[model samples]
Target: MFLRTVTTAATLLAMGVTASLAQDPIEERQQIMKDNGQAMRVLVPMARGQADYDAEAALAAFVSIRDDAARFGELFPEGTETGGDTRAKPEIWTDREGFDAAVAAFVEDAEAAVAAAPADLDAFRPVFGAMAENCGDCHEVYQVPEN
Candidate 1:
């Protein structure tokens, strides 16, 4: 139906409909990481993000990260775009299944990290560190730090 109308096709293409379907999962994963990273960076700096500072808002942020981290696993579907500038190393593509398992681990750990966050600064520190460690672990094995 969409292709039947030349005008519609043009509109869809302009709206970013042409190439995404053809891209592999890795590409999607990398884009997701970059996007999520942007969001995390922004939220982490806010005083309301810390439990000691604003327990409610900080918990909200933690919950968001906790949930998003799990969903993020879908973005890195192995060999889809691992060779690109993504922090993911090429080895990830070589062992696609393992890569996915790693993502699962991160998701689980991230949730724990978020859950561990307490309303105190001291408590929030370790919880947040856990979250960062999950990310760092992946980067160490499958990703390259951005220059």
Candidate 2:
């Protein structure tokens, strides 16, 4: 009897730890977006000629954004719309296909930017612009405007 009781308690404890390990989706998604934004800040100045372009830094930035974009759709799971101070729109759940397509496009653009490997500001401009546009397009329809 004592062994059975101890086993059940251990099982319950393990479940509690597992549940706590899962982040709230809204916070998780926001952190991912913030990380992507930080990566952009590293590349945008170089692309705009405001800072000297470093190929390695640019590649790293693209990789960061692409990695984050790859997981974008998975982060918007249902029931995550209103809580944890989310800026995600309800339309994300209703128009899931559109939301998903946008994420795919963002990922594609990031990959293209990485493959292009622009060595200078001029070469990087168009690729950077396209990626920025993808971000704006997704934000326009899926995210709530910040006050």
State the lDDT at 57 in candidate 1: 46
Q: How many residue pairs clash in all the candidates, one count each? A: 5, 0
The whole-model C-alpha lDDT of candidate 1 against the native structure comes to 0.59
Q: Write model 1 residue lDDT over 1-147, tens digit each, in one string.
A: 432364344334422522362365555555456544643553466534532254444555566456556666566553455355566677677777777777787777667756776676666666666666767777788776668
Candidate 2 lDDT tens digits, 4-75: 465456445534643453577666678777767777788778867888887767776787688668777898
| Candidate 2: segments with Cα more than 4 A from true spot | 1-22
**Local lDDT at 74 for model 2:** 90
Candidate 2 local lDDT, residue 11: 41
TM per candidate: 0.60, 0.81
- In terms of lDDT, the poorest run of 10 residues in model 1 is 10-19
**TM-score of model 1 vs. true structure:** 0.60
The stretch of ten residues in a row with the least summed lDDT in candidate 2 is: 10-19
Best by TM-score: 2
